[model samples]
Target chain A: MSAVGGAAVPAVDERVTRVNPLRRAFTRPEMGAVAGAVAVWVFFAIVAGGNGFLTLRGTASYLEVAAELGILAVPVALLMIGGEFDLSIGSVIGAGSMTTALLAAQFGWNIWPALFVSLAVALALGAFNGTLVLRTGLPSFIVTLGTLFMVRGATIAITRITTGRTQVGNLDEVAGYDVARTLFASSIPVGPAALPISVVWWLALVGLGSWLLLRTRFGNWIFGVGGNTASARNVGVPVGTVKVILFMLTAAAAWLVATIQAVNFGGADVLRGSDREFFAIIAAVIGGNLLTGGYGSVVGAAFGALIVGMIQQGVVYAGIDADWVQFFLGAMLLIAVLVNRAIRSRAMGGRG
Target chain B: MSATVSSRVAAPAPPELAGTTPLLEVRDVSKSFGSVIALKDISMSVHAGEVMCLLGDNGAGKSTLIKILSGVHPASEGEYLVEGKPVRFGSPRDALDHGIATVYQDLAMIPLMSIARNFFLGSEPTRGVGPFRRFDLETADRTTRDEMAKMGILLRDTDQPVGTLSGGERQCVAIARAVYFGAKVLILDEPTAALGVKEAGVVLRYIAQARARGLGVIFITHNVHHAYPIGDRFTLLNRGRSYGTFAKDDVTREEVVTMMAGGEELEELGHELEEFARADGLAAGRLGEVGRELEAEARG
Candidate 1:
C-alpha cells in the first residue's frame, strides 16, 4: 500500500513513502484510550450533570479514586509493555500495609520506622517475585498468580497469629503517624475542591514513566524485549533483566498504593486491596495496552484508571446500582480491546 | 556421494584472491556434537565486494557453519581468519565487535517498533549527560533514513513500525543496520527463502547493493535460482560435507543444483522411485514425478 499522505507531497524521491503527520498521532498507544476517556467523560457529564457529576467536588471525588488506581496501573502498563504481568500487586498492597500496621500498632513501634521497614519488606517481596519468575522461566502470569495467593495467605496468617485478629488498628495513635500522613495522605486545595496527594503521586509517576519509556535507553530496551524477546536477545538486548526490573517496579507501585490506602483508612485490614489486582489490569487493558505484550503506553493506563473512576462514581451519581460498576468495567475492557485492535492494525499498516 | 569431500576442499582462497587476505576465511573446519559429526572438513573464503552463496538442502550443516562463522559456537578443529590473522570468538557479540555481522533468517527486528528504534535496538544512541540523557531520536531517524537510502530505499519517515514494511524491505533494513554498524563480512541466512518471487528479486537486488557498497556477503539458501543470479561464487553442501566451491562462470545452474543434491545419489533415488511408481499407482506417481525432475537435474 502507498503511504497515507504520499500524494500530497510533490515528487522529490518518487520511491519515498510519505508519512502523514495526522496518521502518526494515531500510532501512539495512548491515542485510543485518550479518545475513549473523553467520550466517557462526555457521557457522564450529560447524564449525571444534575446529580453534581460535573461539579468541582465531584471531579475531585473521582480523581482521588482514579489517582489511587492510576498509581498501580501505570507500572502495570510498563510491565505489560515489557511483555510480563504482576498478578500479586493486590497481595503486595495487603502485605506492605500489614507490615506497617503490625509494626506500629501491635508491636507499639513508631510509624516512621514501621513505614521504613515496610518499604524494605515491599521491595524485598518485589525482588522475590522478579527472581522467582526469572529463575524458574515460568510465565509471569502463573508465577505472580502463585504469589498472589501465597502473599495473601501469609498476610492473613501472620496478622491472625500476632494479634488474634484479621485486622490492625491504633495506627493513627502511633508516634510518627502525623508526619507520615503529611507526606502521603495529605491533600492540596484546588479552587472549590481539595485534591488528594495521591493525584500528585500519580501525575509524577506518569511523567517519570513516560520519560523512561519514550526517551531513555532502558525504555528502548523495554519496548524491544516486550515486542520480540528472541529477536531482542539476538541483537544483545538483556531480555531477562528488562522483565525482572519491570516486575520489581510493579511491586513497588503496589507498595506505594498500599501505604496511601492504609494512611487514608487509619488502619490495615487483611482484606484491604482485594480484587485490586484485577482492577489494575482492567485499567491497563482499557487504556489500549495489548495483553500479548510489546505494544502499550503508561499514559493510556492512567486514562484507563480515569475511566474506572468515572464508572465507580458515575453509577452512584446517576442513581444506578453500585454493583453494576463491575459489569460496566467488564464491558469497557471488552470494547477497549476491540477498539485497540483496529487502531494497532491501522498503525502498523501505515494507513492511519 | 560416498567420498569424504576432503579432496575437493579449496585451499582457503582462489587465484584472484591469492595475494590479498579475504575478509573472512575458514580453513578445514570440522565440528562434532559428542559422537555425531555436524560438519566435516569444510573450507571457504569471502572477499570484500563479492557474494559467496552457501547452497544446501536440509541437514546440510548450513546452520552449523553459520554458527561457527558468527561465533555462536567455536570450531572443533579449524582456523577462522579475518585479514590473515586467526581469531576465536566466544560469542556472537565478539564476532560482531570484530566486524562480522550475521543477518539471520528472522532478521532480528522487533515488528511493532519504529524502523529507527529497531535499527538501534540493543545499542541505542543517546545524547546529553547523566540521568537526563535520552535516546537521540534525531540522529537515529536521520541515520536510519540515510542508511536505508544507501541500500537503495528512500523513506520519508523512519518512525514507521518494521511490521508495516514488506519482507524484502525488512531484510534490507537488517542488512543496512549491519552495514551501518561497520560489518565487514555479512552472513545472510536464507534471506529470500521466505519471500515471493518479486520479493525475492527485491532482496537479490539489495544483496547486489550490499556487494556494491564493498561488503563481503555470505548468502545461505537452498534455492539456486535466487542465488545463481547475484552470486560471485557458489559453495555447495550435501549431508554435512562440502561438495567444493565453484565460481559462477565455472558451473551452470544445473551443475550447481546437481552437486548440491549429491549428483550420483540423486540419480539412484530417481531410478528407485521410478521402479516404485510401476508397483504403486497414484501416490507413488507423485513420487515418480519428483524422481523424473531429479533424474533430469542429475544428468546436468
Candidate 2:
C-alpha cells in the first residue's frame, strides 16, 4: 500500500511459512549434478591418483577442457530452461572462429577488431534464428536445426572461396594478439597449477547467469515464457523478447568460445565446433535443467560441465579406453536426468 | 427468488438496472467465424458486487461471447462498453488495462512454478532500479500468502508448485490472483466444469468472496445448479441467441432448466433419436430408452 507499486502488495511481516528449510535445500535442481561431479572425482582419485589425476596439474588439464565447454553449456542451459533449443551454436562457433581468423590473419586486421566483428556476426545470426522461430511459429529445434546446417554450409563455402582451404593460419602475426591471448588463452598461476583464463570466464558467466535467473525480472519472464507461453502472453509477459534474448546469449557464448580457441591456436578450422552443441546440451541436461523447460539452474550446468570435464580427462589418467568417453557421457546424462525427475516430482508433491 | 418471469424478459437494457452503472456491459453483440455465426444478438451487464451468470450448453456461443469479452476476439457486430465508455481492446492486455481480467479455464498459471511465482507471472514486482533491479521473491511470497488467506485458503507453503494443488484450489488461486491484480470485472470461463463437487463448492465460495469484495463477476457455466444459487441474474443463451436475461426472482430452478434445455426442441430430438434407434440395432436398447425419457420429459 505504501510503495504505489501496484494493487498487489505484500505486508512483508506475515512469516508463518510452513516449508522445511532442509527439504527445500535438497530439492535444488543442481544438487544431483554437484553430487555426481563429486562422485566422478572420487572415483578417479582412487583409481588414477597415482597417475597424477589428483595432482594440481591434472586438475588444471581437466578444468581447461571443462571451462571452454562450460562457457557454451551455461548459455545453452539458460536457453533450454526458456523452453527452446539453439542447435546452431556449434555452427555459430565455426562461423565466428572463421570470421575472427579471416579478418585477423588474411585481412591483416587487429585481433580485437576481428573479434568484435565476429561477435557482431554471431549476435546477428542469433537474432536471425530467434526471429525466424518467432515469425514462423516453428519449434526452435526445427528452426535452429535449419540454421545449424545453413550456418555451417555458409562458413565452409566462405572459407573455401577465400583461402581454398578449410583451415586458416598466421593469426599469431595479427595486431593486439598478445593482449587478446592474455585475456582469453593465457593461464593464471594457482599454487602449482597454471589454470586457463577461460576457467575464469566460465565461472563468472555461471555466477552472472545464476544472478539473472534467481534475482532478475527477465529470469522470471524466461520461466513464464517456457512454462506456459500462452499464459505468459495472457499476463503481459513479452514472450518473444525473452526467447530472442536467450538465443542471442547462446550465440554470444559461441563467439566467446570460438574466439578463445582460435586465438590460442593462432588459427581457425571451418569444422572447429562441429558437435559442441550436443555437448553443451548434454552438460545442461546433466546439470539438472529439464528438457521440457520452466525449471533449471545455471550453477547446475557448471557442475554438469565439471562432471563432463572429469570424465574426458579421467579416462586418459586412469588408462581407460578413450572410446568409453561417449558412453560415459551418455550414461551420466541418463543418470542425472533420472535424479532430476525424482527431485522435480518431490518438489511438486506438496503437503496436503 | 424462484418465481416465474413477470415481464421485461428480453429487454436489452432492463429498466430495473439502478443507481450506479454496470462495470461491464455489451449491447446487441454478434460474432461470426467465416460463414458460421457463433453468437448473435447477445446483451449482458454485470454491476459491481454482482455475479451475472452466463448459462448455456456446449456449443451454445458461451465461449465465443467470453472470448469477445476478454478481447481474444472481437465481435463482428456489437458495442463493448467498460465503465460506461465504448472501448475497443486490441488484446487481452488492453482489456486488463481497462481493469477487465479473464481467468481462463486453463488458469494460465505455470504448473512447475511455485504458487508465489505463478501468482505474479508476467506482472512480477522488482526491487531497485535498472540493471540491478531484481524479482523480489519475498514480496511475491508474502502477497500470495495474504491474497490466498483472504480467499480462505491456508496454504501449506507459497513455495509449493501450483500443479500440486487440487482443481478447486487452483481455481481459487486464479480468481484470487485476478482480484489481487485489481481486476474490476472478472470473466471466469467454465471454472467449475472440471472440478469435483467439493472442489466446485470451494471455487463457488471463492467466487462469492470475490463478489463480496465488490468485484463484478461473469460466472460462465453449463451447470444450472451451480449458477442458480450464487448468480444474481441469469442470461440463458441457446443456438447463438439469448432466450432472455432473467433475474433469479422472476425464475424458478425447474423453469430455468426447462427453458435452457429447450423443451420443444427436446421433443423433436427425441423423435429423431427413436428413428435412429430403429435403424441401428446395436445401440437400439439404450438409444430407445433415452429417446422415451426425452419424450416423457418434454410432454410433462
Candidate 3:
C-alpha cells in the first residue's frame, strides 16, 4: 500500500487476477459473429462447391442484399444500446415510402421535396413515439408496438383511398429520380462483381455509429441512461433527452432505408417493410447489444447484420430451402442471446 | 482513547485556524415540509481546513439540513450564507457553481460506466471542431488515473466499471471528483454507514486529507465514535433541534454520546434494564450482560 495526498492507501489484495478482461468480453460478440460467418462460408463452400459458394460474385451478391438491412440495423442497434426499443421502425419505413410516393407520384412534387417531407414526417412520428413514452413513463416496447400497427393501418388506408390501390409507382418521373437511383440503385464495380450503393450507406453509418457510441459525450450518456437512469439523472446526464434522441435516430434510419428501397424498386408497397424491425433487433442482439442495455457495440451489431445476410444468401447458395433461412435465423438469435447472457454474467462478476 | 484525548487537548490548536475565515455559513436556516417541521432555526459554520461533524440518529433532521445546504431543497425560513454573504440556491448546479459539492450516501455514479468515464461524465473533454469534435480519451484517462492516485487509490485499470469497486473506494472516487472540480466545501452524507471497519477507516483518512488541503468538510454520520476521532467541531441534533455545537477540545467523547442519547432517557432506560436483570437473576456473563443492558437502555 502507498499513500498520496495524505489519503489512506488501499492495500493491494496480491491475488492473481485476469488482465484486460473487459477488452476480451467487449470484442467477444464480433469474434463469435465472425467465427460463425466463416463457419457458414466454409459449410456452404463444402456443400455448394467452391465456385458456387466462395466466388467473388457470390460474396458481392450477399453483401449487396445485406446492405439495406445493415443500414437500418446500425441505428436500431444504437437505440437498443441506449436501453429502448423501436418496434415501429418497420412501419416508419412504410410511412416514409408512402409519403415520398404520394407526394412525387400524385402531387407531382420533385423527388428532393418529397424526400425532405417524408423524412420530416418520419422525424415527427419518431418524436410522437418518444413523447408518448416519456409522458406515460411506460416501456417503449409497448408504446412503439402500438404505433407499429397504427402506422401500418394508416399507410394502407391512405394509399388505397388516394391511389385506388395498395401500391404507388411512377416515382421515376419525379425530378432527382436519376440522383436517387444513382445513390440507391447504382453499383460500384469491384473486380468482376458490383456492390450496390446501399452498402456504402451501411458502411458509413456503421462507422458513424461506432464513433458516436465510443468517442462522444452523448455515447457516455447512452450507457449511463441504459445502465442506471437514477444514477445518470443524479449526475445530470439528461436521461430523457438521450432516450428521445435515440428514438429520433431510429426514425431517421427508417426514412433512409425506405428512400433507398422505394427508389431502387421505383414503387412503394403498403407491406414493404413488415417484420424488418424484428430482423434489425435480432441482428443487434446477436451483434452483442445487450437487450438489457448498458453493454453493447455498434460494430458487433453490424457484424450481426452481416451474419444474417450471409445466412440468407448462403441458404440459397447451398441449394437449401430458402424458407429455412427464417428458421435458421430464429435459432441463431436464441443461441446468440443465450451466449451473450453467459458472457455478460462472467464479465459482470456473475451479478445481474 | 481517553489518554489520546488528554494529549490532544494539551497540544496547540491545529494550523487550520491560521486563515481565520469561515468558508461556509448557515445563519439560522429553517425548513418545513407542509405540516412537518423537518429543521428549525439551526445555525452552523465551517472554516477551511476543518471537519465539522454533524451527528444525529435517523429522522433527526440531518437529511433536511443537508438538502438545504446542497440545494436539493430550499430553506423556507432563515438564510444560507456562503462566505458570510446571504445567498439562495436555485438548484444543485447553482450550489456546485459556488464550489459546494454534496456526496450523498448513495453516490451518484453509473455503475456500469468505466471509472474514467464516470470521473468526467457531465463535463467530458473534447477535441476537434463541430461534428468532428471527439472525446479526449487520453486526457480523461490520464487525469482520472492521476486524480485517483492522488487520493491513494491505485486502480489496476481505469476502464473497469465502477460497480466493481468496493463501497469505500467508490466514496473516495466521489470525494476526489469534488475536490478536483474545485469544491471549496464538501458535504458528505453518511459516507461510511455501509462500509466495513477497514473501509470506514479509508474514508475517514480521506476526510482528514480533504481538510488538510484547506477544503471545508461537512461530515454527517450517526456514529459518534467515528466522528469523535476526526472532528474539529461537533454539532449534535435530537428530534430536529440542535443539541449544541462544541469545539472538539471542549467536549469529551462520552459527553457527546450522553448528549446524543438524551441523559434523561438514558437514566430511565438504565432503571428499566436494571429491574429486568434483577428480576431474572440469570446473567449471561457479567460484561456481556452489562453491554446488552446498556444497548437496551440506549434504544429506550
Q: Using lDDT as the measure, name the better of candidate 1 and candidate 3.
A: 1
Candidate order by decreasing lDDT? 2, 1, 3
Name the best candidate (by DockQ).
Answer: 1
- In candidate 1 chain B, what residue range of length 10 has the lowest lDDT sum? B1-10
Return the interface RMSD of the candidates, in order shown, one decimal each.
Answer: 4.8, 6.7, 5.4
Which pairs of residues collide in candidate 3? none
Better of 2 and 3 by lDDT: 2
Clashing pairs in 2: none
- What TM-score, computed on C-alpha atoms, does each candidate reach? 0.91, 0.91, 0.86
For residues A184-293, could you state the per-residue lDDT of candidate 3 as single tens digits? 78889988888788989999999999999889989988887887776566556777788888899999999999999999888799888999999899889888888877
Highest lDDT: give the candidate number: 2
How many residue-pair clashes does candidate 2 contain?
A: 0
In order, what DockQ does each candidate have?
0.48, 0.41, 0.26
List model 2 lDDT by residue over A158-223, tens digit each: 999999999999898989999998988999998998999999999999999999987888988888
What tens-digit string does per-residue lDDT give for candidate 1 at B3-27? 4344444444456766877999998
Per residue, candidate 1 scores C-alpha lDDT tens digits across A1-352 of: 1342233223457655555768768767888889998998898998898899999889999999899999999889999988888999999899999999999988899988888888888778878888898899899899999999999999999999999999898788999889889889999998899999999999999999988998888999999888888777767777777887788888888889889988888899987888898999999998888888888898999999999999899888888889999999999999999889998998888432
Question: Which stretches in model 1 have alpha-carbon errors above 4 Å?
Answer: A1-24, A108-110, A350-352, B1-11, B19-22, B25-37, B40-45, B73-91, B244-252, B272-291
Q: Of models 2 and 3, which has the larger TM-score?
A: 2
